[model samples]
Target: MNESELIARYFAPLAGPAGLGLIDDAACLIPPPGCDLVLTADALVAGRHFFAEDPPDAIAAKTLGVNLSDLAAKGAEPLGYLLSLALPPDWTERFLDEFSRGLGEAAAAAGVALLGGDTVATSGPLTLSITALGAVPHGAMIRRSGARAGDLIYVTGTIGDAALGLSLRRREIAGGALPAWAKTLDAAELIDRYLRPRPRLALTPALRACARAAMDVSDGLIGDVRALMRASGVAAQLDLARLPLSAPARAALAADPALLESVVTGGDDYEIVCAVAPERAALFEQLADAAGVAVTRIGAAAAQESVLGPDGAARRFARDRFSHV
Candidate 1:
């Protein structure tokens, strides 16, 4: 059997309800009355999602966080998850302790459980896969296909920080010293965003109320937002002047103006990118403010296929999509 086929036959039985026969891209779970089931999955591989030498606990936390983030986009309260792990022999002790600690901590924070999964030895690089299950009220789940022309586009949290952190990591790999800005910042948080990104679960209710369309920024903002537009059969016009660049990122941009494009196209932000009707824009602002999460209206949906800049100039977005392959 192929890799996924093997998972379906051997692991599906062990996965219980969340497996859904391992048939669809995601399992369809039925929730209680007045509720909807939300399903999302994320997989991480060494040298791709993370480096082999990175801390195991951090990697574990990030794997879970990305999955949780998926549920967050649908306004789902996490229920539980299944894990599939591939480990090499040398990584046993440290990997176990750190990975378990990270996973346990994220599960507790997200109010989820580590229900069941499989562990196997592999000659390939370490890999971790997590499938998170959650529940939202019926008709309350947000979707990427609900946007319309003239809807205002919004995003949560700061962008570009995680990409910056990755650049710093690359510098470290090249035997260069950490830059000054990197030295003063919280390496753990930066690395955590790189490793563990908290899914914005808290923003779901607010999103459902005010968002016409929504998605998490796993791919770069430009690319993911474009996907949302495509899914909804629309286009977009972005105000490049309003992108919420973090202070450090601003500093980095000061050094190199070209970084602006990187900030726009780089991925792993994990923040929510949403669309709101013009009338609901104020409500969204209030909700985001009350929740203490930064939200910015950076663009608007159009009935065309391309995104425009503030000056009415056509700006190119990332052509590449994030892929497991």
Candidate 2:
């Protein structure tokens, strides 16, 4: 299908009322009284952010899901989103069908609707760009710069599932080396975690209620925490053993301790990292628990950024970022 025809057929039905039925060049948004708007955008390219052979539905979910994660980190409720999809010439109808289906499902689940955006044919790889909008109370949006010394740091969900899943996706591990967590080491579940990130939107109420500072862990945990510390003009004291690991991840680490570094420094964990004041840490965890979200205290904000190893010595990571990926 051509650009206009494709958009009208596949995307128009997903537009929100503010989207002007996808007939206008611009979308309208009016924030609620005493509320601040949150905006986040993410771009995904085939063969870079995702495998070219990945299902169109998964690509659509991840493209929008990552953006929602940013909003979640800021303690905002998703409002609406704009999508710009670029399709290669060889794209098929089946691809568009499933991609749009995924987009609609994810948007509805996140309480967001489609706003207006562009669609075009690209000679390059399949690319998706989404600009998501969210809402929060005035002066209530959590920021990376709000952390202070003596605050406790918490990370939502487990870490490194996505990173380990990527390894399985690349066929990096041998068949005989499955983890004890599962007969197949729950390989499909790991891969699904990589493809479909669980944005902690439900945890936002707790974050807004108690978090002093917050940011989503997109890059490696160590690098993202360091970035948050730098933004807050404070330091962090982290315990390596405190890092929460899923059962499969724990089993994998037991089999090969070397994977620990990769777990700490690989990308796409997509969990929220937040700093809560000492007095509020208990309430934060309580709220998170009520929301059915698992949060673990891994460290505290300090005068200097330090990570302690299991041997009770300060250890340094070879790289702060996802350079390994």
Candidate 3:
């Protein structure tokens, strides 16, 4: 079908009044009184972001969830999102149907409406981008520069699950043989973590109430921590032992300790990492418990550079981060 027919049949229903039924060339948004607008955008490309055979629903979830993760880290509530989709010449109706359904369901669950965007045909790979809009109280948006000396570094959810999950997924995608350790771990769970990223939106309340600085862990945890610390103009020492790891991750690490480096540097984890003043620790924990999200105290931010390992001094790590050049 053509873009107009596709929009009217599959996407128009997803739009809010601000989108003007996608009939208008532009979207109009009015933020809540006394609130500031928060905007974030992310893109996903075929083969790079997800396997071609992966479920359309999972792709939609991750495409939008990654953007929402940024808003959550900033302690903002999603207002709406603009979606741009580029489909290859041979794109199928089934893919479009499933993808739109997944995207609609995710937007509804997040209380975000669809704004107007462009849809076009592409000769290259299928691609999608979302520019999400959120609202936070004026001057209250969390940033990566507010942390102070002596602040405790805290992270939401387990680290390295998505990274390990991605590795497991690669093996499956390439039809490679799984190693002995792979048989012992929860492969399904790890793959799910990689495919469906859970943005820590529930923890925003506590974060806004207590966190000094915040950012999402889309990159490796160690790398993200370093980024946050650099932004705050402070050095930090993370306790490798205190990193919260999922059962599968722990089992994988136990089988081969070398996987520890991959776990630390492999990206794709959408969890939130933040700095909390020592005095606000109790309140933060209380709020997190109320929200049903587990948070772990990983380390402290100060003017130092001595990380501690599980059994001794910090173990030397290779490539603390991964990035696309």
Candidate 4:
């Protein structure tokens, strides 16, 4: 099918009212009264972001879910999104069908609707990009620069699952060397964490009410935490032992403790990390619990410009996190 027919058949039903049935050249969006709009964009390209053989549905979810993650960190409620797709010559109609089905499901789950977008042919690889829009009460949007010295640092859910999952998918980890528990771990669960990340939208209200500063962990924890610190003009002291790990990850680490470095420094974790004042930490945890998201306090901010380790000593990593550069 051609581009127009492709959208009309597979994507039009996903459009919101503001999408104008995706017939117009542009979409129209209006924020609620006394609220400010929040916007974020993310892109995924095959071979670079996902394996070439990954499912189209998963690719669609990741493309949109990553953008939703940004809104969650900013304490915004999602409204709608625009998608742009670049199709490789080898792409089939079946691929588009599954891709749109997954995209539609993700949009519904996030309480957002499709706006409008573009599709084009590409000679390189399949590429998907999404620009998500959300809203927050006026002047209430959380920021990465609001963290203060002495504020406690917290992360939602566990970390490093996606990173390790990617390693497994890429065959970088020797499956035979893993512990029995690790070997028995369901491959689908680990890989699903990598492919279909659950954005912490449920925690947005709590973050708006309690977090001093927040950002989603797209890059590795170590690098993203440092980014937060630098943005807030503060340093942090993290306890490596305190970094939350999933059971599979824990089992893998038990087999090889050195995997801790990979766990801490790898990326693609869509969890949220935030700074909260020491006094407000308890309330924040309570609110997050009510939202059904598990949180853990891993460190605190300081006036220095360094990240310390569990030994209360400053340490350096050969590579802190993933960099597109």
> lDDT per model, in order?
0.77, 0.88, 0.89, 0.87
Residue 64 CA error for candidate 1 (Å)? 0.6
| TM-score of decoy 2 | 0.94
TM-score of each: 0.85, 0.94, 0.97, 0.94
Which candidate has the highest TM-score of all? 3
If both were scored by TM-score, which would come out higher, candidate 1 or candidate 3? 3
Clashes per candidate, residues 3 or more apart or on different chains: 1, 0, 0, 0
Candidate 4 per-residue lDDT, tens place, 15-108, comes to 9999999999999887799999999999888988888777889889899999999999999999999999888989998998999999999999
Q: Identify the superior model by lDDT, candidate 1 or candidate 4.
A: 4
> Model 1, 246-303: lDDT tens per residue?
7777677666666666677778889999989999999889988887778998889998
The better candidate by lDDT, 2 or 3, is 3
Per-model root-mean-square deviation over C-alphas? 5.7, 2.4, 1.2, 2.3
Model 1: how far residue 162 lies from native, Å: 1.1
Please name the candidate that would achieve the greatest lDDT relative to the true structure: 3
Q: Where's the lowest-lDDT run of ten residues in candidate 2?
A: 172-181
